[model samples]
Target: MPSVNRLLHPSEAAKRLGVSAKALRLYEQRGLVEPGRTEAGWRAYGQEEMDRAAEIVALRALGLSLAQVKRVLEGDSQGLEPTLAAHQAALEAQLRQLARTVEKVRGLRSDLMQGRAPTVDELMNLQAPLREVRVAFELPWPWGGELFELRDIRSLNYIIGPLGSGKTRLAHSLAEALPNAAMLALERLEDDGVTAAKSRMDSDPILKSRVDEAISWLVEDGANSSDALVVLLAGLEADGPDALVVDMIEQGLDHATQEALIAWLRRRGANARPLFMLTRSCAILDLSAVGPDETIILCPANHSPPMQVAPYPGAPGYEAVATCLASPEVRARTAGVVAWRPSSGRLQSLTP
Candidate 1:
């Protein structure tokens, strides 16, 4: 066994604490952790630092902001009540979902013992919640008038594909087909668009309040206010839309912002309005964060019909979805690099 008093390198310390080395550095920067230094000037985390870092990580896992974490670490409990309440609500929602799944499994097992085999659709239904909304329509251009049927739309649905894969077309079609759904387009970020969005927010006090709360939450997660984000949030929290299809939901937002946005959406629980978000950013489409009330649809590079992809690592089209998504850091590095497509040739030329 390792010595209890032994100090560890940054990577080893982070491993023990179940966090990233970058996160350790962030804590140090925020003055939440103070590590010793080697003679070579490398950071060294001793037992004291490790213990403190563990506390920070626990607070963060509870959705506390870094600032809030700092405050709590300094013995301030004034803000803990609301944060804990939110966490409790989220936990309760998850427990309810789990209970429903357990009941379904029990029923299925009972059927099996009685010499009854469940249908494929019935088996699949046991895995996910019954979708409350669905859309069926003919796919638009690039796809040859193929009928597309999206069943059991979840609270959060991600529409993802590479450039020229017709993901945008799918999103638009979904917006038109879903009852009372509207698409929040990129044009919302154009000049005077922000002003119009702000004007709408001003006209509605409840919406403005919700928007402000969301913005504050995002800021706590390291997001800064931008016209694009504000406009997007305005539409997300807007009244009267049964659902919303958002094109490039991560547009103009940084990695932190995307992470925060997804977390916030997940916490909205099962009753949140359904959202169809088109995204290429890994942060926004995190495979690990896809919940029971979430679904993923991938438009293949070959322009085949879009299909819902199971989020598991080895599921069909899961690799393709993973390939199409990039970390925000990688996205930032390749922001201007676009794949070349010949305008007048057979689409086959663009394949692999």
Candidate 2:
């Protein structure tokens, strides 16, 4: 009897799994497997890998991509199960609709064969009701090659900038741009404004209570419509989970606060419609200054001048700004001004 000691090459494993070796290579490219290697640097696979290969084929039969199958096998099943289930449900729904459509077509064929006078409504109304399927397309913003499209907006986003550098202006602009956005003015959050709101947002009970309060306000004000966009604005940063607060921190947000906010955003940012816009002020506003996980910086036309801009919830709405700012001509005009460093402050464009 052959024992499990036989190490299989990728080709052998593919043959055993009843799939082509090309399929296994494709899976590997997608981080599905970390194959071992022989002394000659040839790829080798173990029994575990082979088993996973079989599972991959099975999942593909169910219409899963290699990336999706790898996600399933990796045990990070948080969102995959629902997604797969949704796909199955959609397929079932489509099959039913197709069956009805086929039956209608057969009936129409019979009517035509009988030489009956076909009414316009009779032929047109035979089709099923057209359901509006929401599909999001990634549209590129003209400003600095930025891309903006519908996505799940998170409850927390870090907007880093220096103090009084038009942070609030941008934030307010975004608030106005976002339709029905729920604005939470962290009145009690700032040291000078509200010390307690900062502490309140840092805790789960207080945070939940405050969020609920904001929601209640929106509902009562008739602003909580289905298409309402919620903008959670917190002033004066505190280190805590689920708080979408931004402050001017030149070195980036405090470690604890940054981690908490990132985790919070990841969870709430999973929405499909992106109904929320998180606005806050960060001290460290340079996108290239810190690590990618730390900040999503919005750079100016030129990558220089290192001035930080607070991320307004929806201010500088990329789409609208792109329509106005979209031009290679603008960048070319501004190119000369980059080298002209001011001795005092931000430069004002003299160009008309």
Best by TM-score: 1
Tens digit of per-residue lDDT, candidate 2, span 225-256: 22111223232222232322222221122322
Per-residue lDDT over 105-146 for candidate 1, one digit per residue giving the tens place of the 0 to 100 score: 899899999999888988877667533677899989999999
Models 1 onward score TM values of: 0.70, 0.29
- Candidate 2 structure, TM-score to reference: 0.29
Give the RMSD in angstroms, all C-alphas superposed, for model 2.
Answer: 15.6
What count of clashes does model 2 give? 17
Model 1 lDDT on a 0 to 1 scale: 0.85
Cα lDDT for residue 1, candidate 1: 22
* Model 1 regions more than 4 Å off: 1-63, 81-131, 329-337, 341-352
